[model samples]
Target: GAISYVSFGYINKSVQPISINGVQPTENNVKNNKWKIWSYEHIYTRGKPTGLTKKFLTYLKNDHIQTTLFNKLGYISV
Candidate 1:
C-alpha cells in the first residue's frame, strides 16, 4: 500500500493486504516460499528476440534493474 500510494493512487485502506496461511507477503518470504500467493508472468516472442527487444529484455532481467526499477514500480521480478 505504501508503495502504491507513492507510485499511484490505487491503494484502498479499507482493503487490507492479506497473508497466505501464517506467512506475510514480503519479498524474501515470497521468494523463498515462506509465502506463496503469486502467479507466473510470461512474455511471448515470435521466433526469437533480437536487437533492441533483446537488449530491453536483458536490461529488464538485470539484477540491479530488477531491484531498483521493477521492485520500486511494484513489479515482481522473475
Candidate 2:
C-alpha cells in the first residue's frame, strides 16, 4: 500500500509533578488537549505532545499505550 493518509489527534491532559519520575511539566496548572500523556507521537500527524484531552486519551488506550505514560498522574473513572 501507499504511504496512506496521515491523522491528527489531541486530548486534554493535566500536567503535574511526579515525585517518582522526576518529570515536572512546565506548568503547575493542568491543561487539556485531545491526546494522551504518553505516546503522543502515535496520536498525531503533527501536534503538541503534552497536556492532552480525553478524546486522545481514549485513542491512546486503543493503541494499548494508556498505562505506558512515563508520568502517570493517575486517572479517575467516574
Candidate 3:
C-alpha cells in the first residue's frame, strides 16, 4: 500500500460546509431535518470529572459562554 492524499474536515464559516443535493448545510436546515450530514459532540471519561474538566464543562454550559463564545466560534449550542 502507498499513501496518496490526505483529508480534513471543517465546520461553519471557517470553511464552506458541503451541500447535500444543492441544499446548503445551515442551522435552519439541520433543525428542520433537511440536512443530514452532521455529528454530535460528547464528553467522555471513565468516571465523573473532579477538577478542571468539571469546571470547564460548567463554563461551557453557562449562558454567557453559550451565547457569546459558542456563537463567536461558530458552534451551535445543543
Ranking by lDDT: 3, 1, 2
What TM-score does candidate 1 reach?
0.68
Report the lDDT tens digits of candidate 2 across residue range 20-56: 2453333222233222233223435355444456566
Cα lDDT listed for each candidate? 0.65, 0.36, 0.66
| Window of ten residues with lowest summed lDDT in model 1 | 2-11
Candidate 3 per-residue C-alpha lDDT over 1-78 given as tens digits, one digit per residue, 9 for 90 to 100: 332211122342444445669887776786688977666567886688878888988888999997787777656666
Judged by TM-score relative to the true structure, which candidate is superior, 2 or 3?
3
| Backbone atom clashes (below 3 Å) for every candidate | 0, 15, 0
Candidate 3 wrongly placed segments (more than 4 Å): 1-14
Q: For model 2, what is the alpha-carbon lDDT of residue 56?
A: 65
For 23-49, candidate 1 gives per-residue lDDT tens digits of 766668757978655556578888899
Q: How displaced is residue 15 in candidate 2, in Å?
A: 16
Displacement of the residue 1 alpha carbon in candidate 3, Å: 25
